[model samples]
Target: MKTNVYGDFACYYDLLGWSRFSKICAQRLKNFVRFRGKGDETILDLACGTGELEYRLRKTKLRFVGVDMSRRMLKQARGKNKGVKFIHGDMTSVRLKRRFNIVVSFFDSVNHLGSIAALCKMFKTARIHLREGGFFIFDMLSPEGLAGWELVEIRRKPGYTLIINGFYFPERTLAEITIEGFVNVSSGDSSGKTTYKHFLQKIYERSYPLDKVAESLTKAGFGNISVSSFDPDEPIENASRWFFVVS
Candidate 1:
């Protein structure tokens, strides 16, 4: 079982622009599905952190089921979203018995798998849950894109402060992100006294060559695979994340 890698971050996952990004991704996905998927179909969302995507698409008639490894993230997701089923499990190996018309893992969640073998397992899991002719869509960190994330940055706001340090190892095609932050916690005693707790989260991600990923997808029983950079306006050579569409 995976540990609570998103323990503290789950509390603030949407404090940044991530929620906004989810809206954009949801809209784009809706457009993609309009062309590639039947209008009324089931969707399985792997690594469905905080259920932001489902919340954004709540108006749609499509049904959704979400799975994630983090209990804390699921807690928030369940609390905020209704009529969508959420399960706690690893994306690489969980089985739901039920199949879906579309399976998606967004926000570079696949990068956290850390190796090609794990990615292959994830691809298989997606295939297992997808109905015949269904689609599997995922995003991954691109080595060329990860190259620009090597830096240190800090953000301070009322009641909290966050610092992010990022490093990319060319030799290993890996990226490491360290996020440390402190949020003020308040409680009422005989007299009200405020306290604070500090949190530190270190995340490691690995990227493979496109060819290697495509080959793995092929072995996982997917055909008609397509890869594109995440941003339509940006050149593929400069984007840090790429999307893989398979059927």
Candidate 2:
């Protein structure tokens, strides 16, 4: 069984300490919208995990739609933000009839597509549901960033422990991850104790050159393209994770 791919893992992803990072990215997104969005209030969160980003931005006067492939993840996200609409679908192929003012895929989620064609599909999907002059925002891992994936990491979060082993294949620009961990779950047996359940899974991510991504956006008919570090103010050459903005 693929223990960490989805199912139970999706239910406990919030405990894996992703909220802090999501909050940072949400703030970045907020800034981007304020300075560049041109009065667009509709948001599309691609692969929105646990809806944490949406919850973080709840104080804002924006309508949100979240799409994720994991049913359990979408369930968790929906539970967290009842007003936000969430759909179960793949990032590469999901389509929403309504166009959004801003479409965002953060946390280097684009790398998970594992191939240029899959990434193209996601970009086209974003293009399809994007309003004219709307901004498309996403982050990706560079080849240099993928090069750093050759290690074993251990993380102790508030409610879980995560162990991950990473392998990078230069020829394919693929990073293979083997994740194993234990998530603390509440037990209603009146013992006032928690149980840690084990999980394991594998994931593959691919790295692409910025030129390739820019070419795809060009082919998608996007204009005013900009690529920078996760911090929009910084340059991309030295940054591991790069963010793209297309208008």
Cα RMSDs, all models: 2.4, 2.7
Question: For each candidate, what is the lDDT?
Answer: 0.85, 0.82
The best candidate by lDDT is 1
The window of 10 residues in a row where model 2 has the poorest summed lDDT is 1-10
lDDT of candidate 1 over 70-153, digit per residue (tens)? 898898899889768999999999999999999999887888887789989999999999998899988887988776668898
Off by over 4 Å in 2: 1-5, 38-40, 186-194, 231-235
Backbone clash total for model 2 is 0
Model 2 TM-score relative to the real fold: 0.90
lDDT of 2 by residue, 1-247 (tens): 1212366667667777655678888888888778865444898999887899999988887788999887888888989998789998888888778898889998767888867877888888889889887888888888888878989999887778899899989988888887888987766688988888998767778888888988888877787898888755556787788878887
Q: Least accurate stretch of 10 residues (summed lDDT) in model 1? A: 1-10
